[model samples]
Target: MKTLHDLHRPLGATGLMVSPLGLGTVKLGRDQGVKYPSGFTIPDDRDAANLLALAQELGINLIDTAPAYGHSEERLGKLLRGQRDNWIIVSKVGEEFESGQSRHDFSPQHTRFSVERSLKLLGTDCIDLVLVHSDGQDVEILKDTGVYETLDALKREGAIRAFGLSGKTVEGGLLALDKGDCAMVTYNLNEQSERQVIDHAATLGKAILIKKALASGHVCLDSGVDPVQASFELVFGHPGVASAIIGTINPLHLSHNVRVAVSVIQSRR
Candidate 1:
């Protein structure tokens, strides 16, 4: 069986190599206002540590987290500890979750503050990637705010390696790729509306990190079809997809996901 590390590839032209299966860390922090099909308790430190260890063992290097994910950043800081160099940490700015509510602020000031805070929280000097957490109005945020520009500045200053938008719309994804190194889009069996964005990224050598690739575990596959295998096949079938961020907290699910992802990727090759 191939480990995820065997499937690592360039993140567009960003110069950072990431696993085909990046682990999403939403369940490590906040639990409110999420759209998961079922509820899950936030894992304790020991459990979280075991999960990370399993991810590392499976050769997963890319990790996804954001300020909107509640205490995720801080928890990762503690859990990751001395193993920072073993993983590629991807955090985000613009969206903030607090008091059981979520809000957005894409101003340049907020963008800078968020990156700096993430650095402090994660106990790292430079983040591998940081993205703009768009609030539905992807095009407006990209054009109206100085957020992308601020991220560029931060990148040049060595606070972040690369930056882009975790966008909501096809237009926004295209625009983000036009100005940045990557764009996180929602693509899965249920959603192919962003295929244009993926094609565009492929043409431009920009990274496309897939969100909701399994439809947040709400997938309705045909009877007798294996949902995990089917989802991985659909996602990895795309030549432009750099990675799929699966946010599974269950260890068995994580291992199964990696195995399925490896099989799908290998079959494609």
Candidate 2:
């Protein structure tokens, strides 16, 4: 039997390798104000560097962050500078950020700027993959030739090793996954509405990663569940799911998350 640590696997039908588990930096860096609307606000940055180092040592290599995740990309880049070769950094486009209140930036110039800034902030020459982050609105711009064609050109220049979508809705998620290259992340399992999409991932050859599966840890408490197993395994059980992106601020919490991820993958076999 593969131990919990060994459950991390390569992405399906692609050369991209990842630990089936990943470390999300939103809590450690971007989170601000109370987490009332969400849950469990982030801790201070005292241990952000330490925890990230620990995650890397533990072989959790898919490090995810976004410009929308205020300070997350900068913090991660600061800690991970010069080690770009050892990690796969995934950033997002379509999110606009200026003076801390920004919206979607789908124009080719803005999209290009987003990638350039992400690369600069992360202290890397190239990004392993880039996803267009959606907040469940105005996604018609995605089908536009300008944004995608720009991304395709970046792939050719090797500025991005791959490209894909990260949608907030099933209509948008499925469209992006089917029409473009690579994967999409969405709210899965908790929403029965997404079941067909989850099932469809297996047949599509498109890598499907899940987010909010634990309902940001809300459903777990409400439904009398621990959330770790239910959320991780529910989506991961589907052959389509490549991984579930979860975030935390504490080292012990991250350790627990790693255990859950390992358990989910191991149980499937």
Candidate 3:
């Protein structure tokens, strides 16, 4: 089994190699209205730095963030300036959270502006991956909006390396796989409704990233079963999964997740 220390793999056909475990930064920015099993204080700068360093040390190279994730992009900009080349940044557009409420915008104009803003906010000249944050109207947005066309243009102009959708429905996921480089879908023990999306991505040779792989901390492990290990086993068991985005602010939890991921991968061998 490939250990977490050597878990890097190609992200579909993007030509970019990424760690099998991507670190999600939603908790780094937002704490309110979140659905975690327990409350957590947002980490301070020092703590954030430590956590990032720990993630890197554990061989995680993909960092998932978004404009809707409070100040996540800004904080990552400040924290990851000198280490830009060391990570593949996956950020989203079309969704914004303001005043504790969420809103969606998939217009080409907004998509372009959002990518530009994300580049500036993350202090990077180019983003590795950008996904349209869907508002549940996935098929409609893909059909009515020019977001995909706009992102393709940006890719041609060297503003972004790849683009896709963080979509809701299986139909939307299939569309995204057909039209983009990857798809971020929700798949976990509690919710396996999106497994077809992963299967489709595999058939199409596109990347599939698992979100809420642990049921967003709501997974209840049976006796003698470790939640982290069980969750990772299920996720990584799928050949289509490029990475599982685990959002954990606690260094201990992060380390344990890494260990479990390594064990699961090794057991698969």
| Top-TM-score structure, candidate number | 1
For model 2, the local distance difference test gives 0.70
Candidate 1, superposed: residue stretches over 4 Å from native? none
Clash count, candidate 3: 1
Q: Once all C-alphas are superposed, what RMSD does model 3 give against the true structure?
A: 1.4
Worst 10 residues of 1 by lDDT: 1-10
Ranking by TM-score: 1, 3, 2
The lDDT of each candidate is 0.93, 0.70, 0.92
Clashes of 1: 0
Model 2 TM-score, all chains together: 0.87
What digit string (tens of lDDT, one per residue) describes model 3 on residues 141-175? Answer: 88889999999999999999999999889999999
TM-score of each: 0.98, 0.87, 0.98
Candidate 1 vs candidate 2: the lDDT winner is: 1
Candidate 3's C-alpha runs over 4 A off are 1-3
Tens-place lDDT per residue, model 2, 1-269, is 22234556655555687767666667755545423245555555557768777787666878778888877888777788667777777788887555646677777888888888988888888887788877565257677636777887888888888777777666766676665655566554466565555566677776666666656555534566667777776777777777667666667767877777677677778
Candidate 1: Cα lDDT at 222: 83
Cα RMSD to the true fold for all candidates: 0.8, 2.8, 1.4
Best by lDDT: 1
Clashes of 2: 1
